[model samples]
Target: MSTLPLLGAAMTVAELEGLQDFILSRDRDLELQDFCELGALDADWKPAAERAKALLQGYKGRLGIHGPFWGFTIASGDVEIQKVVTRRMRQGLEICDFLGATQMVIHSPYLTWDYNNLDNHPGRKAYQNFLDYTHATLDPVIAYAEKIGVTMVVENIMDKDPDIRRILVEDFNTKALAVSIDTGHAHYAHGSTGAPPVDYFVRRAGNSLQHIHLQDADGYADRHWNIGEGNISWAAVFRALGELTSNPRLILELRNKSGILPSVDWLKARGLAE
Candidate 1:
């Protein structure tokens, strides 16, 4: 049985510094999401990175990053768009290097509408086009990440099923590329796009599963509520995760910093963590 450490997603540098004691007290890790956005890698990042490093000094837990996903698609078919996306991702990798983060989470380019529209095309050609574009877009980014020793984990946002995501990771066939499942996104996909249950993602990713965003949703929208505050099936999800040979980092991606401790307590009370 592979057990994963509980992690907290700090949306800002100040919040992470404020909660440093609380996070380390529970032996949890940190996944910094603030610097992973576009335009965030500017001059201000230097000071923020310094502050984060100072705050995390002597912290023994592993670190991860939620890479930039807004305003960019890594699998864009347009060359210019792909270039911009890759540029932002390369910046994200620079931040990862600064923080010594081993794993970086990126949004998967598989959209539900795009996948569904494949039926309108002739005989998997649309699928092939998507694959080709994704490969073209991500290959350079993956190469850079490998050079810096950062594992790029593509997360599911609009994917209605695991097949596309699984295929995307396997197609790369590199150790630097893997899958990340955001529980709230999976729940939303299930309700809005008829996606498989949340457990299906864990089961399908299996060994390739490298990261997780553990949040609860009402199954209608991405609520990002604390665990036990919504309708997600925690027991089923953890059961599936227990079968994985690889231990994926599980981060509590709550909407606010205040929910972090309560969410940790909630998981402990339910035996999801120690």
Candidate 2:
């Protein structure tokens, strides 16, 4: 048995309802993104949380959760919005505790639109303000996550370069704070922002790279196709990953359940995963 970094796929609660055998048979870990949405957080999250716990009843492998991000901005200029984001994320951490999830993925709020507008304001001052605001909003959540022993991995969503995320993770300077690189997002950033190739994210985050959403994309949209269905250089990307000293969780984040096994088979055939 090869002890390669745990390979898995993202799944919703609905998707896993009747597909436990199909999912657990192929992957060693599950990145639960369904419970991270706003609607699921309503009603004290009781119903959803109970369902999630039931779903993982007998599975022994690791579990991860993607934190609530849609319509929420952790680094927003609006104070009320920041409050809502923190509240929802704290709920996410609570869910992590209930599910025994050691890692949780939070999407980075950094956006190219904000970066572009920075020039109109002042020298790096605007960017610095954004970082400060983000830290202030997430500091308490990060503290709680640390206390609960959950690694809060921030995933790159709209970052033009890895520097912004690297800075955010390094500023916290804690084992609990790390980066989650999404291959499809990196490819999109490369095309949209002229950022470095997808592998650069791995190299830049290095040991701090704690999680990965491995998916293929056509450099234009977040297609989330099967591993070999897009143009990303998997060999180069995996080569960079192989150099990392940290054993990051590699979760194939295909958009559809149908693409999961094919993605797994693609990697297994190339000896990239066990």
Candidate 3:
């Protein structure tokens, strides 16, 4: 376990101010939590982007942005809603291009309820509808991402069936599509909704897993606490990661930005991460 597992933090520009030197020394799997609001990428975007670029002038790391995910669904069958979602995605790409980011996080549309209902219909018409609408909504953005060398990693939100996203990425059949796991999200679903455990998510995602949000949470909610503060088996999670060839970016996503270092220390003390 002392193999020096790569780990980094997901934070805003302000939070990164004093921590730049630390990140410079560790794994550079940095994820920027900016421009993730419903309309944050429009007029109120440039100043923050410029500030972040200036702050990270000499930082050479794998950079990613949390794509706009609030108040929109990519699997919407409504033509107008699709247009809105498409605009947000394009806007996110604009920021990614400016910041030289290679990855963007998009939330999955598969709800916990979908497991039972999606296949209940004859011939799985409901599942087919979800796939059809999702493809229609994302095809153009994914094409643009591919052309520009950016990978759009589909993140599990309320997704209980781990295979659904893998199948969606395979169906798309493009280099731009990949999988992302938020540990806290999986843990919450595992305890509350009967979803598989976090370690199972890692195994299920397999080589397609491109990014992970490294947060610890009680099974009660998406607590986003520092690692070692939750009931999740850190050893089990690391063991699962050990079997992966993807080398996914592990970004500590905590609500309290100052918890990043302590979380890393917890993992390091246990010989699970460095």
Q: Which number leads on lDDT?
A: 3
lDDT of each residue in 69-116, candidate 1, tens digit only: 888787788998988777777888888898888888888888888767
Local distance difference test scores for all models: 0.82, 0.83, 0.87
- Measured on C-alpha atoms, candidate 1 has an lDDT of 0.82
Comparing 1 with 2 on lDDT, the higher-scoring candidate is: 2
| RMSD in order of candidates | 2.0, 2.1, 1.4
Off by over 4 Å in 1: 1-7
* Clash totals for all candidate models: 0, 0, 0
User: What's each prediction's TM-score?
Assistant: 0.94, 0.91, 0.96
Q: Which ten residues in a row have the lowest lDDT in candidate 2?
A: 18-27
Ten-residue segment with the worst summed lDDT in candidate 1?
2-11
Sort all candidates by lDDT, best to worst: 3, 2, 1
TM-score of 2: 0.91
Candidate ranking (TM-score, best to worst): 3, 1, 2
